[model samples]
Target: MTRFSANLGFLWTDRPLPDAIRAAKAAGFDAVECHWPYDTPASEVKRALVETGLPMLGLNTVRGDVGAGQMGLSALPGRRDDAVSAIEQAVSYADETGTKAVHVMAGISEGAEAEAIFIENLSVACDLAMRRRLTILIEPLNAFDAPGYFLRCTQQAKSLIEHVNAPNLKLMFDCYHVGRTEVDVPTTLNKMMPVIGHVQFAAVPDRGPPDHGDVDYRPIFSQIAGLGWDQPLGAEYKPGGDTDASLGWMVKFR
Candidate 1:
């Protein structure tokens, strides 16, 4: 069966992180993940995980200066210090909460400089996470949603992972982003499965529930299962209204 992880970042936004973790358990999710949980203390998050017995699959590094339009820091030139700080913070939190991975966000930028800075920052992230026996992940955001975001394609992410040369560093193959930017989802997934550390999905174009998307996830989920991916696939969609009301798809998908 294709188990799912509720992405607390988007799933249960109305409540606290601890509360959201419990809600995911009640909703039958096998695991949980988040975007940025820095504001919520690690102790509280840890307590909730212990209470619910749901593994925290992963979480993203902080997006630096949202007010300044910075989505991430690692890829921005002249911001290596900030990026390293974000990566360290994320790894520490993940370690405390028993999370398995950290998604190092590459902020908006482009060209050779951005790529170099990104790789440098990723090396730092990988080294820090390796100490905790945690995986470091890089995700390719779709151009439409994240224009100018440094990492924008699976090929680019794969090449960077190779260049970084860290075994713990891997790709976060978000199906919705790839489906929006690439030609075929399963083919791309099949080709990239060897380096994939995690997977996520949402409705393409709409970023809603997978059940009502341009890309059908049923076959893709089965394909992943066949490929020996035993971890819970991440549900990172935005619930149009109350998150509870939007969970019908989970039942059907499961």
Candidate 2:
């Protein structure tokens, strides 16, 4: 059972928020996820989730800077307070909406010192996340997608999860980013599967639907299916054209 989560942040962009939920439900996604509801009221989002009867997957915490400069500050020095506070707010949101997973990235490090600080800060956030009954998903962005990002490789993410030694903290494998950084998808996934808590996908280069790019999703998908990964496989790609038009290939997979 390869259950997929339709990313409302990218899919159904033209439709209203509620409509997006309905559309994803009809599209056969087992659940639906989106970025943080900064503009939309949580009540509205909650209503949509209830109406569609879809589980919420990933939700983001507020970054220290909303502007162009900051990615996130989860592990930076002097930002520990802000980082914890951000997760707290996200917990409040998640608690209300029954969302149990939060993606927490340590914003890019400026240097070795910053990297160490970020690791310490993330260690604290992990504890808090556990207390809140939420799973913390740490994503490692490739240098191409996010230059100067603190965690740039799956190896680094794996080390952090190991060092933290917390059960609730795990890695977020964004297949698109990993595909840009590594050559083999199935091999890389096998290497990082233990730490990987959530999985997302997008076509290479274009970051669109799975079939639109060179990455062969069939094998990658089959690999996970063999692993008995019953949770949702997040479809977190941007639609190059009409969302429905781009998703035609997935009908057979259903």
Clashes of 1: 0
Sequence-dependent TM-score of model 2 = 0.92
Question: With candidate 1 superimposed using the best TM-score fit, by how many Å does residue 252's alpha carbon deviate from the native?
Answer: 1.5
Total clashes for model 2 = 3
On residues 94-182, what C-alpha lDDT tens digit does candidate 2 reach at each position?
76777768887678676667767766766666777777687888888877878888888899889878877889888999899899888
Clashing pairs in 2: 72-107, 75-118, 108-150
lDDT accuracy of residue 65 in candidate 2? 79
State each model's CA lDDT, in order: 0.93, 0.80
What are the clash counts of all predictions, listed in order?
A: 0, 3
Clashing pairs for model 1 are: none
